[model samples]
Target chain A: MIVAERKPLDEIEAMLASAERVLVVGCGTCVAVCMAGGEKEVELLASELRMRAQASGQRRRIDQVTLTRQCDREYLDALAAYVEEYDVLLSTACGAGVQLLAERFDGKLILPALNTRFIGTAEGPGVWSQRCLACGQCLLHLTGGVCPVTRCPKNLLNGPCGGTNHGKCEVNPENDCAWTLIYRRLEKLGRLDLLDAIQPPKDYRPMTKPARLVHPAFQTESAPPTK
Target chain B: MKDSIACLGTETEGTGSGAFEPKVVAFCCTYCAYTAADLAGAMRLEYPPNVRVVQVLCSGKVEAEWLLRAFEEGADAVYVAGCALGDCHFLEGNRQALRTVAYAKRLLAEVGLEPERLEFFHIPASAGTLFAQRAREMTDRARRLGPSPLRSKQAVESRKLVLPPDPHPPLPPAQLGRRIRESEEL
Candidate 1:
C-alpha cells in the first residue's frame, strides 16, 4: 500500500488561512493503514483546526468526511453534494487521492495534508519500512523475497559486496546487509549454485519508462461491438 | 495587621466553600482500565463520583484532540488508562497512547492549561486494585488543583471576540450557476 505521513499542523493551517469553511477529507485505504489519514485522523485534524481557529478568534466552520477509497471516482462522487459547502478541501489521502479530489472538484481548491512516502508495509507495530522501489520489474525469485533495490543502499542485483561484514552493511553498521540476507536465504534453500549464474546489467529503460499492467480478466475486447 | 485582615476575609470565604467536585473524563482501555473500574464497583470500593469513563477499543485510539475536546467540553481532568507498556493487546497501542498523551501534555501547556490535569496510567487487566488506587490518586490531585483555568472567567474575559457566524447566506445559486457555466466554457 502507498504510505504517507501527515504534514505539520502549522503548514496545513497556513494553506487554509483564507478558507472560512474547510472540509477535511480522509481516505480509508492506504493512508488509513499507515495511520497518516483515516476517519479517526480526519476528525482529529478537523478538531485541531477548529480549536486553532477558535483560539485565533476566527469563527471557521471545519467539517470532516471520510471515503472508503479516495483515489476511486465512485467513492469521490459521494463528496459531490457537500463539495461546494467549503472554500477549500484538506485531503488526507495519498498523492493520487489528492489529485483525484482536484480533478473531481475542478475549480475548487484542494490541498494535501500528507506527504506521500512510498510503497511499503508495516515492519512492526507503528513501524513502516519500504520494501519495494517499484522498479517496473520482478527479481524476487533471483534474490529470495528481498528486493535489494530498496533494502540495499546500493541497488546491487548480485552482491554481498566487500562492504558487507558480519551480516551488516558497512554503509551503516546498524542496517542489515541485504545481500547477506539474500545469500543466507539462497544457501538455506540449497540453491547456492543459482548465485554462480551471471546476470546481465539491469535494463534501466524499463525502470525509467512509465509502466502499466492489464489484468487479462479485466481486459476489454479490441474489436468494436456491432450496433 | 493587613495580612490578618486578608486572612479574615479568606476565612469567611472558606466557610462558604464546598468540597471540590472535579469533572474528570477517564479514557479507559477496554482490556484493562475499564474492566478494572468495573471490578472496583463490584467490590464496592468507593472512589470519587466525578469520573465519567469512556471505553475505547485501545488507548492508542485516544487522539490528542479527544483529550483536548474533553477539556473543551468542561472536563476538569482527563485520564488515559491502558495496559502496561510493552504488553498492549494490539502490540504497540499503549506505546502510541503514551506518545499521544505526552504530546497532549505539551499542547495543553501551550494552550495555558496545567499539563498535570491530563494523566496516563498503565496497568494490566489483572491489576484491578492498582487501577482503582491510581484513579483515586488522580481524582484527589485534580480536586486539589480545582478547575482548569481554561474554563475560568479570567480566561474567557481575556479571549478575543470571535466574529459572529456568517450572516450572508452561502454564495447564491447564481454563483454556482456561473461556476457551472464557466466549466462548460472550458
Candidate 2:
C-alpha cells in the first residue's frame, strides 16, 4: 500500500499562514491504514490548528473532512459543492491523491499535508518497510520472493555484490542482504539452478514516467465527430 | 451531554480571593480508580473540588482524542487514573493508558501547551487515600501552571452562541443525544 507521513507542524502552519479558511481533507484508504491521513488524524490536526490560531489571535476558520478515497474522481466530486468556501484545501493523502485533488479543483490552492513515503507494507504494528519500487519489472521468481530492486540498495540483479557481509548488507548492517536471503530460500527449495542463468541489463523503457493504462474494454479507436 | 461528562463538583465553586481555580478532568477506570473514588467519598476524605471525574470502562479505553479534547474544552489539567500496573482489570489496560498518556503529552507539547498538564496515575481500588492524593496533586499542579491557554478562547466562544441551527430538526431526545455524543466521540 502507498505509505505516507505527515509534514511537520511548523511547515503545515506556515502553509496555512495566509489562508483564513482552510479545509483539511483526509484520505481514508492506504494512508488511513498507515495512520497518517485518517479521520482521527484530521481531527487531531484541526484541533491543533485551532489552538495555535487562538494563541496567536489569527482568527482562522479550520474545518475537516475525510473522503473514502481521494485518488478516485467519485470521491473528489464530493468536495465540488463546498470547495469554494475555503481558501486552501490541505490534503493528508499520498501524492497521487493530492495531485488528483489539484486536478479536480484546478482553481483552488490544494496543498499536501503528508509526504508520500513509498510503496510499502506494514512490517508490524506502527512499523512499515518498503517492499516494492514499481520498477515495471518482476524478477522475484528468479531471486526467491524478494525484490532486489528495493531490498538491495545496489539493485544487483545477477547476484550478491561483493559488499554482502555474512548475511547483512554492507551499506547498512541492520539490513539483511537480499541476495543471501534469496540464496537460502532457493537452496531450501532445491531451485538453486535458477541462479546459474545470468541476467542481462534490465530494460528501463517500461518505467518511463507518467505511465497510464486504459482498460482493454475502454479503449476507443477514435473520437466521434462533433455535429 | 451524549456520554455524560461526569462532573464530581461544579466549576464555579471558587476558592475565594479571586484566585484562578483550575478545572481538572480525571478519567477514572471503573474497575479500580472509580471504585477508589467511591471509597474516598465514603471515607469523607476532603480533596479540592476543582477536579471533575469521568468514569470509563478501563484505562485502555481512554483514547488520545479524549485527553486532547479535555484541554480543547478548557480543562486546565487532565489525568487518567487506572488500576496499578499489573493489577489492571483487563490485565494491561493501565500499561496501555501509560503509553497513551505519553503520546498525548508529546502532542500537547507540539500544540505549544505544557506537557505536564496531562498525566496518568496508577491507583488500585484499595488505594482510596492515594486516589484522593492524586487528585490533590493534579489540582496543585494545575494551580501552579495557571489557567490553560485554551480557557480564554473557550470563555470568548461561550459568550456568543456559535452553534448553527440543527439541520435535521426533528429527532427524539435520545437519538439526538446519541447523535451529538457520536459527533463528540468522533
Candidate 3:
C-alpha cells in the first residue's frame, strides 16, 4: 500500500486562508488503511483546523466528507452533489487520489493533505516498512523477496557493500543489511548457486515517465465513427 | 457533534460535575491487568473511578490509533497495563506494548497533546494493590493538567467556524492567490 502523512497543520491552514468555506474529503482506501488521510484523519484535521480558525478569529466554515476511494471516478461521483457546497476541497488521500479529484472537479481549488511516501507493507498493526519502489522491474524471484532498491541504504543490486558489518548496514547500524537478509533466505532455500549469476545493471529505458498500459481486449473494442 | 467533543466554553473549563474529574482509558491485558482490576474490586481496594478499563486479549494488541483516539475523545490520559515483564501469557506481549507506548508518546507530542498523557504500567495479576495505586497516580496527574484545550473549541461560540456548507463556490486558484497577496499587502 502507498503510505502517506498529512501535511503539517499550519501548511494546511495556509492553504485554507483565502477560503471561507472548506470541505475536507477523505479517501477510504490506501490512505485510510495507513491511517493517514482517511475518515478518522479527516475528522481530526478538520477539528484542529476549526479550533485554529476559532482561535485566530478567522471566519471560516469547515465541512468534512469521506469517499470510498478517491482514485476512482465511480467512487468520486458520490461527491458530485456536495462538491459545489464548499469553496475549497481538501483531500486527505494520497497524491494520486488528490490528482484524480483535481481532474474530476473543475473551477474548484482541490488541495492535497497527504504526502505520499512509498509502497510499504504493514509490519505490525500500525507499523509500515517500505517494501517496493515500483521501479517497473520485477527482481524478487532471484533476490529472495526483498527489494534492495528500497531496503538497502545504498540500493546495492549486486551484493552487500564492503561497509556491511556483521549483517548490519554501516550507514545505520540499526538497519539489518538487506543483502544479508537476501543471502540468508537464499541459503536456507538452497538456491545459493543462483547468486553466482552476475546481473547487469538495471535497464533504464523502460523507466519512462507517465507510463500507460492498455488491456489486450481494449485494443479491439469497437470505437465510435471517425470524422 | 459527530466529533464527540465533550465540552464547550466556560461551562467546559469547569466540568459540570463541579470538581475536575479527569477521564482516563486503561487498556488491560485479559490475563494480567484485567484480572488484576477485577481482583482489586473484589478485594475492595478502592481506585479512582475515572479509569475506564478496556480488556484486551493482550496489551500487545493496543495500536497507536487506539491511544490517539482516546485523546481525541477527550481522555485526559491513557495507560496500558499488562502482565509483568517476562511473564506475559503470550510471550513478550508487555514488551511489545512498551515499544508502541514509546512511539505513541512521540506522536502525541507532535500533535500538541502532552506526551505524559500516555503511559505504560506493568504489574502481575496478583498485584491488585499496585493496580489501584497506579490508577490513583494517573488520575491525579491528569487532574492537574485541567480539561484539554480542545474541549472548549467545541462550544457554540465556534459556530462561525463550523458554519453550514456555503453555496458560493471558491474562486480559481489564480484569483485566490491574488486575494491573499493583496490582503497581505494591506
Candidate 4:
C-alpha cells in the first residue's frame, strides 16, 4: 500500500490564504488505509481550516467530499457535478491520485494536502516498512525472499558493504544489513548454491518514468480467435 | 449561538437537564475507574451528580476527538480515569490515555479554551474513596471556571467554528457558474 502523511496545518492554511471557497477532496483508498487522506481525515482537515480561517477575520467557506478512489476519472465524476462551485480543490490522496484529479478537473485549482511517502507494507498494527522497490525485476529466487533493493540504504546488489558492523548497517544503526538477512534465509532454505551464480546489471527499462503497460492477453485487436 | 452551533453531533445528547449546573463528562476505563465508581456507590460515598461517567473497555478508547466533542456538546470539563501505571489490563492502555490527554491539552489551550478543564486520573479499582474524591474535585474545578464561555453572550465563538453546512458569504449559484467558466480559460 502507499503511505502518506497530512501536511502541517500552517502549510495547508497558507494554501487557502487568498481563497474564498475551498473544497477538500479525500481518497478512500491508499491514503485512507494509511490514516492520512481518508474520509475521517478530510472532515478533520476541513474543520481545522474553517476554524483557522475564521480566526484571521477573513471569511472563507469550506466543504468536503470523499471519493472511493481518486486515481481514475470515473470516481472523480462524483465531484465534477459541483466542482465549479469552489475556487480550490484540496486533495488528500497520494501523488498519483493528485495528478489524475488535476488531469480530470483541467481548470480547477488542485492542491495536495498530504506528502506522499513511499510504497510499503505494514509490519505491525501501526508500523510500516518499505518492502519492494519495483525495480522491474526479481532477485528473490537467488537471494532468498528478502528484498535488498529497498532494504539496503545503498541499494547494494551483491553483498554487504564494508560499513556493515556485525549485522547492522552504518547508514543507520537501527537498520540491519539487508544482505545478511537474505544470506541467512537462503542458508536456512538450503539454497546457498544459488548464491554462487553471478547476477548481471539490473534491467531499468521497465521502470522508466511515466511507464505504461498492457497485458498480452488484453491485446484482442492483434490476437487470433481464442480457443 | 445559532441552532447549528448550539448543538454538536456528540454523545452528551439533548441540551442537558436544566439548571446552570456545570456538566462534566468522565471517560472511565471499564476495568478500573468504572469498577471504582461501582465500588464508590456500594461504599455509600458522596460525590456530585454533575459528573457523568461513560465507560470503555479501556481508557485508550477515549480518543482526542471524543474529548473535544464533549466540550462542543456543553461539557464544562472532561476527565479520563484509568488504572494506575504498571497495572493496565492491556499493558499500556493507561499510558496511551495519558499521552493523548497531554497532547490534547495544548490544542485546547490554543483554541481559547481553558486547558485545565481537561484532566486524567490514575486510580486503582479498589480505591472507591479516591474515585469519589476525584469526582468532587473535577466538579469543583468546573464550577470555579463558571460555565463554558461558549454559553455566554460575549461568545468565545468555538461553536461557530464547526465546519461544513455553513459557508461564509453565500454566493449566487448563477454567478459561481459563470465565474468557473470564465476562469477555465486560464
What DockQ, between 0 and 1, does each candidate earn?
0.08, 0.20, 0.07, 0.07
- Stretch of 10 with least lDDT, candidate 1 chain A: A50-59
Give model 3's docking category: incorrect
User: Which pairs clash in model 4?
Assistant: none
lDDT of 1 by residue, A1-227 (tens): 89899888888988887777788888888898988899877866765665566556665777777777888787776677777777898899999999999999998999999999999989876788788888877788888787898999988877777899899989999889998999999899998887887777887776764566788777886755779
Q: Arrange candidates by lDDT, descending.
A: 2, 3, 4, 1
Q: State which candidate has the highest DockQ.
A: 2
Candidate 4 on B1-186: residue-level lDDT in tens? 123223432335335576567778888899989999999999999999888788888998777766765665567888999999999999999999998898668656655579899999998899999999999999999989977654322212222112233222234567888989999977
Candidate 3 structure quality by residue, lDDT tens digits, B38-143:
8999999999988878879999988776776566556788899988889998899898999989977876665566788899999679888999999999999898
User: Per-prediction TM-score, please?
Assistant: 0.69, 0.87, 0.66, 0.73
Per-model chain B TM-scores are: 0.71, 0.77, 0.74, 0.72
On the 0 to 100 scale, the lDDT of residue B60 in model 2 is 97
Candidate 4 CAPRI grade:
incorrect
User: On TM-score, who's better, 1 or 2?
Assistant: 2
- 1 versus 3: better TM-score goes to: 1
Q: In terms of docking quality, how is candidate 1 classified?
A: incorrect
Report every candidate's CA lDDT: 0.77, 0.84, 0.79, 0.78
lDDT at B134, model 4: 95
- After superposition, which runs of candidate 2 have C-alpha atoms over 4 Å from their true positions? A221-227, B1-16, B154-186
